[model samples]
Target: MEEEKRRLIMYEKLMAEIDLGIHAIDDSGKTVIYNQKISDIENMNPQEVLHKPVREVFKFNEGQGSTLHRAMTEGYDFRDEKQTYFNNKGVEITTVNNTFPVMHHGEVIGALEVTKDITRLKRLVQENMNNGTRRYRFQDIIGRSEPLEEVIEHAKRATRTNSSVLIVGETGTGKELFAQSIHNESSRSAGPFVSQNCAALPESLIEGILFGTAKGAFTGAENRPGLFEQAEGGTLLLDEMNSLSPDLQSKLLRVIQEKTVRRVGDTKERKIDIRLLATMNEDPVDAITNGRLRKDLYYRLSVVSLFVPPLRERMEDLAPLSEYFISKYNDLFQLEVEGISTEVRKLLASYHWPGNIRELEHVIEGAMNLITEEKYIEFTHLPLQFKRKRPRPPEHNEIFHEEESTPLLKDYLFQQEKTFMQRVLKEHNYRVQETAAAIGISRQSLQYRMKKLGIQKIRE
Candidate 1:
């Protein structure tokens, strides 16, 4: 009886403070005591809450004493981070609650229930999860070329590790896309996948944006969370890591090494638990030599490095992707576009695509906009530069085989420019300017090639 009096005194004292919706109910289901927060959440006064049956508020039995029914029946604590509740007005809200039975001399006497309104919190979390661009798994990466396959294989391998990743590729090569796929496939998929382009922001604002400042720490008056803190237990992709200035690079290195960060102008050190994945277009070696990127940060980031081959190098993936893009744009533009013809295929195959797959996609869509077709994409629909030809007839053996041929960079395209130039001058009766223009070179450059190739023009 003395212990019961002590419990009542403690509950009364707790009622004066402790606000996150706390309530106590006797085994008879009477609201023995409750805090103001509960009444506030229910929009009722404390005087209005006393002596009420908890069943009238909860609309269901809480279980034996404070114990969860599932726990008593299943031999473990029954827990759910999400549970929906509805009010009398048919207004629905989410809640997370924890309950335990009060034991008095081995007999269940009462229950304590702690609940929080999570309806708004759940909405924010769901919004973050449904950010579908990153939600795409490996199966979503649309490519089948050997080079593309290699990248996908590497990305899959990368998903299993927490090590930092450095994806090197030219701009628009889907480096960030690969990073997102990796994060989605990893164990951290349940957590936030935050991404920011380091190159896109200037050095002055980059630090503040990355490591948030406290209230009154800067021009902003509100306390804001940085990407690192927000990405706790998740992945942080620093797109274009190579562009970070040396000072910022040092700060980034410390975060990776120690897993900590200090908010701007705040002496307190906040620890961050984040997985790091970054992309860079510039060569690491060149960046190091030129002092644009720090070598230490590069070493830290490249715990695993992946290269996305240029599009010209992966042309084997061209035809199918081209056809796919044509169809895609046709649907997007509401055009009745058809597939590429044999002649158009020849143009796409022979040209050196410096821009890669992204460039090819743009080229296809651009062509689709101008043409009206149903059966074939004519050669005239291609980019203008692709139409220009070498003056000499067939400098290359020209593989015009069926689409089943192996996709790989051809060796003949690596032939000496001078030899090709000589063949062009000899065939064109040494009209240097016309020959130079036809083969995509200047006359002076052609003359230099003639001197180098020992080709004498038939001077009139």
Candidate 2:
């Protein structure tokens, strides 16, 4: 009995020292031990909670899920169960708990509950989901490609200065991730980091929300500080910059130049201190030509341009990114997914990925949801779109039935080169500049290839 008493004392000491909340109840549901951490979380004294009934102590809502009650009454163990309630002060609290029935000699004796507070983190995640972006640091970016590495290095350098940065990439290329990373790395990281989508709002509201509006400025107008003032001494991200009207673009240029803004109906200009990061979905040059973006504003905003390569260009990262997403979703959905099959990996790598990483993540997530009791994800578990038959050229055996009819490698290479040049020329309507840029080569190089391949522009 003395040895058992000593063990119980040691267990109590260990539980008290730990940071997370822990509380255990006796067989009759009366509290046996309530530690200091639980006291702190509940904003109540340990003395008040000691020797109380479990349901009374927690005030569990009758119909709502109750981890402690279920574990004790049903003799079941629950892991990572979420519970929410109001504390003594009427403050709402959210927690993830592991509640288990304490057994002795193959019979249920009591119940113990361990909890960790995740209220703040949960709120932030919800905000990000609603806004289409989140706070992320450099470590969150997953990539090993040379182009991606170069861009990361450039973004790190950009954090040292207050110059405007323009991140140019196609949609779903993680422009917002880079912007948030820069903000987190900058010297003013402790300050607020605000993001707004220029394309998500109308022009009139966009301007007011960005530059603030004084009372009497318009109907139902109230004096307010816009995103600029809210992000004082910090960073502001303008997403989809090309969507801003020319007049708004001009105003933004003036704000960047003068370092001041005048709220509507107010003549007083407020001096501001902020770092700006802007993102564009389409090519900036195309935006300029289409008059969707002002050229001078582009030059000013792109003082440090960081280009994020599309997924198709960094095919080597597909496997690692896939594994990362799998691990992430496994934690999220509580699955036992070991990894993707070799055939599935190859299929993912070969995909054109017009939607880039975002689309790949959706595919993996969709597949994971349908996978059950599988050690590894297989090609058969992939989405139906992936199951669709893809056309292929004749196989080697079909192309050369005769044993002596082996084709030379150089001849095959020449045919492939000719086909690629013709396809690119046709896609660009034979325009030298567009075709060269699309092919990621200089116009002179494209011209040389055209002459070598004897390819001509197609007429409509």
Top TM-score: which candidate number?
Answer: 2
lDDT of 1 at 337: 73
Question: What is the TM-score of each predicted model, taking all chains together?
Answer: 0.56, 0.58
Per-residue lDDT over 1-460 for candidate 2, one digit per residue giving the tens place of the 0 to 100 score: 6999999999989888998899888888888878888888778788777898756656555576567768988988887777888765666678778899998999888899998765643443334234423569878888888768878999999989889999988789899999999998889788878888788775646777788888767643458777778778988889998899899999999999999988877888999999998999876765887999998898899888887887766777878898899999999989989998877765675555667899889889989988878978888788887567331122222222334333445335757888888887888788988998997876755764564445654542
Measured with C-alpha atoms, the lDDT of residue 412 in candidate 1 is 42
lDDT of 1 by residue, 1-460 (tens): 6999999888778776775777666666677767877666655566655676654554332432223333333334344333555444445555566666667787766666676654543444344344434576777666688768877898899899899998888777778778888989999988888887777666755676678667656432236566788788988888888888888899989888999988777778898888999988866665777998887898898888787766655666777778778889888988877688887777777755656677678778777766864556777776665466321123432654334333333334334555676677778777988898888866755664454333567751
lDDT for model 1: 0.69
Segments of candidate 2 deviating more than 4 angstroms: 1-134, 389-460
C-alpha root-mean-square deviation, each candidate: 18.8, 18.7
Q: What is the lDDT of residue 238 in candidate 1?
A: 85
